[model samples]
Target: MTISFSDLPIRDEFRGMTPYGAPQAPLPVALNVNENTHPIPDDVATDIVDSVSLAVRDLNRYPDREFSLLREAFAGYLGHGLSAENVWAANGSNEVLQHILQAFAGPDRTVMGFGPTYSMYPLLTQATGAQWFAGERGPDFSLTAASAVAQVEEVNPNVILLCAPNNPTGTPLPLDVIAAVYDATDGIVVVDEAYFEFAPHDAPSALTLLDGRPRLVVSRTMSKAFAFAGARVGYLAADPAFIDALRLVRLPYHLSSLTQVAALAALRHADTMLATVDNIVEQRDRISATLTALGYRPYESWTNFVLFGGVADPQATFLALYERGILIRDVGIPGHMRVSAGTEEETTAFLDALASLEF
Candidate 1:
């Protein structure tokens, strides 16, 4: 009488597919997922609580379908001559990405991304019923303009996803590569800059190329630099027409009143909330330098985490750190693992635990 999930009349696409899971464990020093380990400053938390409390009083009313104020705040924070008309937001960057795919890629369309990039790109594409076309990167996980353009020409996909400072490898995508790829295809081009705030201040953003590029989108999240992972606010900037397209597919009043107000409160304290970036960058560098000294090849990262290779046995090293109440990620890359840059003490704990592992 027992029926497995496979026995259900589910869509063929989902039969063997697994959910996106980053291992969740209750370890004392957790650096597994790339979360900002710093707690929200007390003052900021108080203001957020105040905002949420006020919003709760109007619970009978549906939240703003447009989320106009929040969008304006985001545009201001981004400060690239952007306005509310050019920005869109969702519960998280993942949802923002989902909306893009739903609007621009589905069924007969193809969505492409370079391999060993963000693990979510293909998953999102598949969920949208779009064919996922995985392109290639250089051996060092780098993507050049020529290589990217060539791949775009081959696929001619309906959508191209570029993860700047790609996950799992932490290799940054240059602006020229993005520009070349965009020119090579007539499809929607998305640049996920979830980690851009952690990059050097002088590094140019994909936003700089947004002018006259109606098909281009630049996405960001509060999860890393803003220490607002729990708040789950993510947004993007693109042509106003592109933002309008997402509206066609999104649920009405998708962002709740609580979510909107909390995000607005966080945006109000942008400078204070982002002050942790410098410290996190320092810790990230510390992780990379120590990994190199430990004979591991730590890739140059513009993100909050470090992806290091040279472990003789990744699982063994992962477990050893876990046993010591320190958690990191084994991102399914052979001889490699990733760890977030945590607060100073937390970083020290992870580094000490990793160093003690004989492998």
Candidate 2:
């Protein structure tokens, strides 16, 4: 029998969603998605194809459900105490989050976090039929550790979704605060560091917290610092048992052989990716300096993107830049626009785009 949504009543909130679509651009300098404007090297691409081609014979068969090879490469490159036993691979960080919600979050349960986070945490929870609890951040877009900890201790959510160098804002929570919240909450804490590479060294190490806390899970993605947006290799590091739960729900052969090969290749040359990261940091400083000079009050960003206030209306600024062939996200924080830190050329282009704008 075929099912039709027209005949059934689903959740009312689903209908309230604004359809989450954005306009597509041509030649798409594509700064909107926080992707690295740089592509992988020709040599790395060649290696990926070569390795995947060799693994092609097993394409008809299912892949290693554990993705040990990728995990080994991941742990090796990241240089943390991560082992294959403690890692969970997925289609993307998004999938890892979905698995977390499926395993920990449920209808009567809740996933709590601060506002202006990774945007998808609440969406993921709602999609999984769980309640989303959001605590407002201070005016600086910086979340106070004490407030965040209080919310967790009080709400006692099933999953604590956190983003250090939180998306859209790029400010990190204090380390002691993260530890305090962990000590306070018995539930799983999922610290998403999609922008971890750019964060300061003294920032709380989510990996370190995994030891004492059985439920601490940190989600990472190659799509960010590794410059592999198309690769879609994101993972979580946590207690081996928690990782095993992900395997049960994850589809067999979830990641393509080619994608795994590409991730491995990128990881092999982690230094190259890091060089680009250093460049992004430089670009961030340059752009931030320029914005400050323009009287744009910017939050202290530790990620590859910057957010600013003091403009008349950020929507107008975004539209003006959009007309100039640059696409940035209007974070809806009045006078605040988020621009991804790009290469020097792209950074200058963005500055020019902004200079040409009337807003």
Candidate 3:
């Protein structure tokens, strides 16, 4: 007899939970999931293969538990006066965040984020046995300093999550607001800059704010900007103490030799790896502009994706796009949906499909 998941001795809180993920249908012109969608340049691919080959000889031994060289490479990439001592790496930003929660938050603690933010923030908090709650965003998904401070004051959570170029909305937060929130909360303040490279040129990184604030942690991921989503490398910059805290919680040799080598190879070719960022930005603007012209309300996007509102029927529109061999995300936010900027041809297909729709 087949045992249902419900019949297993799972924790009551997890009895009916579904893992967080977007639909993964194999369709042409796929624009969901906020992936880079650009193929790795040939030179980068070759470099990755060569680097991995070098690591193959040492596979029998444990990989670098410290990941020292990899940490230096990442610190150099982040470059806001960061050193390897201030950096920590994990399989992805999600795991990086998990390490943080494991270190700072648990049972009696609470974590808070602005509403309609990244879905994983709450899920990750739950996994740590912490209470997760949401503060509301202003009209147009805007997060203001005043509003952020009010939420921090009200909740007084042990940890606070702020996402720049926030997921599902594509809105970047102002540093002033982050500072305000930081001032209000004595606990850990995490600024998730997963889409930092996609933000406007004038936007500043939270890394610059790290010096005086030992409790501030800025998390980033190579999956988005470096176009190495397949490599699953993510990292963060914070006070050396914070990095040390994460070290205690992370498993020994968690980063595989192959992952380390692949990430190092990509960082070495950083220019080539990030060469398409500009193009993706252009596509993002095009999507926002064209959507606006089509009488849809597309939020100002600082990321590779746009979250647009005023769809008459998001599910129907989503299914229609799927039928036309294109796929976009519904994001389950009322009449709004999000779509990632794909290659030019793929992006054009998505726009053309939307243009063809009668509603």
Candidate 4:
């Protein structure tokens, strides 16, 4: 007899909730998830393999509990006067977030974020036994300093999650709004910058605000611009005391030795690994321009994806693309869909397929 999940001993909060994921399929041209479609440089991959191979000989011992060397490398890459003391990393940005929530938010505590942002924020909050409070964004999915501060003052959450260049909508969050929100809340403030490398070179990061602010954290990932999504590496920078809080909750030696070495190897070739960012940005712009020309409204994105509106039927359009072996995302936004900036040819296939469809 098959047992029902509802009859099991799962937590009440998880009873009816679905796990978070995009539709995964083996399509010819897939831009559903915002992944860097570019392959790692052959030389870099070889070096990573060599590094991992060396690490393989030490399988008997547990990895460094602090992951000091990797932290130092991340510090060097991020610069901005950040040192190893300010850096903390986990398997992925999601885990980094989970750690933050676990440390500062739990049972009866509230975590808040603006709507139409990264969907994972709410899910992560719930999983950590914290209440999820969704604040609103503008009609165009934009947020300003005054608006953000007002929401934070009202909710008074224990933790605030700000997704810079937000997911699902691609709206860029200005530093002024972040500073205002930080000033408004005594809660721990997290700025998730998973797509920071895709933003303009001159764009100021939340890292610039970290010096005097102990409650502020700036999280980043090597998954996108580094073409290391499969490696599952993400990191953050904050006051050393804040990093200490994460350590209190993290499992001992959470990072594997192999993961540490592979990440170190990738960091050594950071410049070479990031060469595809410009090309991806170009494709993203191309998608936006062509979508606008075709009468769809595309938002200004500072990430490697575009969220376009004017789809009369999002599901129908999604299925139509699926039939053509070109998969994109329908991010539960009415009359809108999101697509990643794939390689040039893949982007062409998506555009050509989209153009052929009627409302």
Candidate 5:
């Protein structure tokens, strides 16, 4: 094997590291991954189990190759005027993101995203040897049109990403702010609405804007609000051009029969899941108020989790929660933890844990 092709200029970044499991599963309380904390209702559970059982029978056959039915159903759910041509999916939104980058980005170009946002964005860019730009966000974690406009002029990237109702802090981007960024950049702009179900008033999803700006793309997931994290189903809606870019990079028959069936079941129970989203919204605010009452400064969240400024060390608190059989992510470095909003009972358990802390 020529000693692993040492003479070639193969990528050096991944060569020394063994692949590790995603920091997504097997944790106590499992809140670190920001999953929906509710279990599926009996009827919805039956739908999934039954659908998957039927799908399993087709195991020897290839997947739909395009996952057409799943895409169509997803379009109908989000109310984004989504079409099959404007939709693409993968094992998860993470993989959908990778497909976009693989098709649109290259070693000679760049990708830009805001700071204190998703941890995976920068990592994903680096995987392709693309220059990753971290445009700074305001101290409050919202993007200003002026700031974003200025950064676009400087970064001159091929793609720009905005995680509306973003991860960690959950601050949603305003629509006018998104329009301003679109006006300033000729490159692709992705508005990640991973938490849209919890964000009714923050901003109308950029999905509807696809008519005005063909460069716009909106990504949504069943993982968060639909309680389908384990099913690995995520969808993206965009202008046909952007959607085609994703298609170019997606593997043939990538979405398994397993994921497609599970998502169909979730869609069938959309109203029931929306009810769960209502409960999650209530729990999130309740947790926020409780966090403030306990002297922690929690951000105005539009997602299911709360990001709080605590008096204790983040690593120490993470360990404490871990020892106590609960888990939350100590994200973007020390002193901050992104704790998911669970059921009222789970929220109470987290509140109790916080109350027991000395600082």
Candidate 6:
């Protein structure tokens, strides 16, 4: 006899909970998710193809479980006195985070993060049987060192998630706030820097704080800056001991040989891969400026997406844009929606569609 999912004894906590994801329909101007909307340059594509072909003949063997060479290449790119010993990687930043939670927090332990941040934090914590405490962010969806330290003191969680250029809001937290939180908590502190490359060149990374902070982990992704989302390579820089801890929880040979090849190939052409960043940043600023001029409130963004408020009806606006084949994200924020910085043409199309709307 066939049994439905609920019919079987699934975990009680996940009984009625749905999975997390953004809309992924094949729209003409798809920008719902915060993906780098640029295609790989022709030169980069050729190099990636050549590298993958070299790895195809070795499919019979398992990829290096530790991904040692990849780690070294990643370390070289980071350039903060980091070596392979200080770096670790996984399928994506999410998986890297999961491995972290699995190793450092589980069962009776607790994890905490500020609200209106990355939605995946709680879900990932739940998967590890750890309790989640979502602390509140400030009115503007920003958090201060005082507020963050206060929450860390109160909750004393085993893990804490801090997003830089935070998701949905696109605001970067001050480095002082991160330092303060680290000082206030003995728990593992994860600084998610998925959008770091989008931030201003002068913006500092949490990596600078890793000198004496063994519990602090700074996570980054190639998906955003490198435009290698399809390759799914995300990584972290932390103390060597912390990197070793993650090894205990991650599955063996998790990163495939082909993935390593593609990522390394892309890394060789880092300049080419990141050439469109300035262009994307320009579009992001333009979108923010235009939205503000139109009587909407666009929050200051250091990331590739802009989060704007003052929509008469977010759902209505979302639907209207969808009907026009211009997909953006509602992000569950009232009176607000987010649009990724697409190519010039795509951005122009979205702006034109918004310009014609009554609201």
By lDDT: ranked, best first: 4, 1, 6, 3, 5, 2
Q: What does candidate 1's lDDT look like per residue over 1-359, in tens digits?
A: 99978899988998988889998998899898999999999999999999999999999999999999999999999988999999999999999999999999999999999989899998999998999998988888999999999889988999999999898787888999999988898999999999999999999999999999999999999988999888888999999999999999999999999999999999999999999999999999999999999889999899999999888998998889989999999999898999999999999998888888774
TM-score of each: 0.99, 0.94, 0.98, 0.99, 0.92, 0.98
Instruction: For residues 1-359, write the lDDT of model 4, one tens digit per residue.
Output: 88878779999999988889899999999898899999898999999999999999998999999999999999999999999999999999999999999999999999999998899999999999999999999998999999999989989999999999898788899999999999999999999999999999999999999888999999999898998899999999999999999999999999999999999999999999999999999999999999999999999999999999999999999999999999999999899999999999999999999999976
Per-residue C-alpha lDDT of model 3 across residues 293-359, encoded as one tens digit per residue: 9899999878999999999999999988999999999988999989999988998999999999976
CA lDDT of each candidate? 0.93, 0.80, 0.92, 0.95, 0.82, 0.92
- Compared with the true structure, what per-residue lDDT tens digits does model 2 show for residues 255-291? 8776777678778778877668878888888888998
lDDT of 6 by residue, 1-359 (tens): 99778777988877878899888888899887889999999989999999999999999999999898899999999999999999999999999999999999889999999989898999999999999999998878899999999889989999999999799899889999999999998889999999999999998888899999999999999988788888899999999999889989999899999999898899889889999999999999999999988888999898999999998898889889999999999988888999999999999999999988985
Compared with the true structure, model 4 gives a TM-score of: 0.99
Worst 10 residues of 1 by lDDT: 350-359
Q: Name the best candidate (by lDDT).
A: 4
Task: Candidate 3: give the clashing pairs.
Answer: none
- Between prediction 1 and prediction 3, the one with superior lDDT is 1
Considering only N, C-alpha and C atoms within 3 Å, which residue pairs clash in candidate 6?
Answer: none
Give the poorly placed runs of model 5, Cα more than 4 Å off.
Answer: 1-10, 14-28
Considering only N, C-alpha and C atoms within 3 Å, which residue pairs clash in candidate 4? Answer: none
> Worst lDDT window (10 residues) for model 4?
1-10
lDDT for 28 (candidate 3): 84
Residue-pair clashes per prediction, in order, are 0, 0, 0, 0, 0, 0
Model 1 scores a TM of 0.99
List residue ranges in candidate 6 displaced over 4 A. Answer: 1-4
Residue-wise C-alpha lDDT for candidate 5, range 1-359, written one tens digit per residue:
45654456768865654443435546547677788989889998988899999989889998888888988888888776667777888888888888878877779879999888887887788787788899998887888999999999888889888998878788988888889889898888888898988997545778867787888888888889888887887788887777776767778889888888888888988989777888888889998899899888888899999888864688778777777777887885455678888988888888898788764
Q: Comparing 1 and 4 by lDDT, which wins?
A: 4
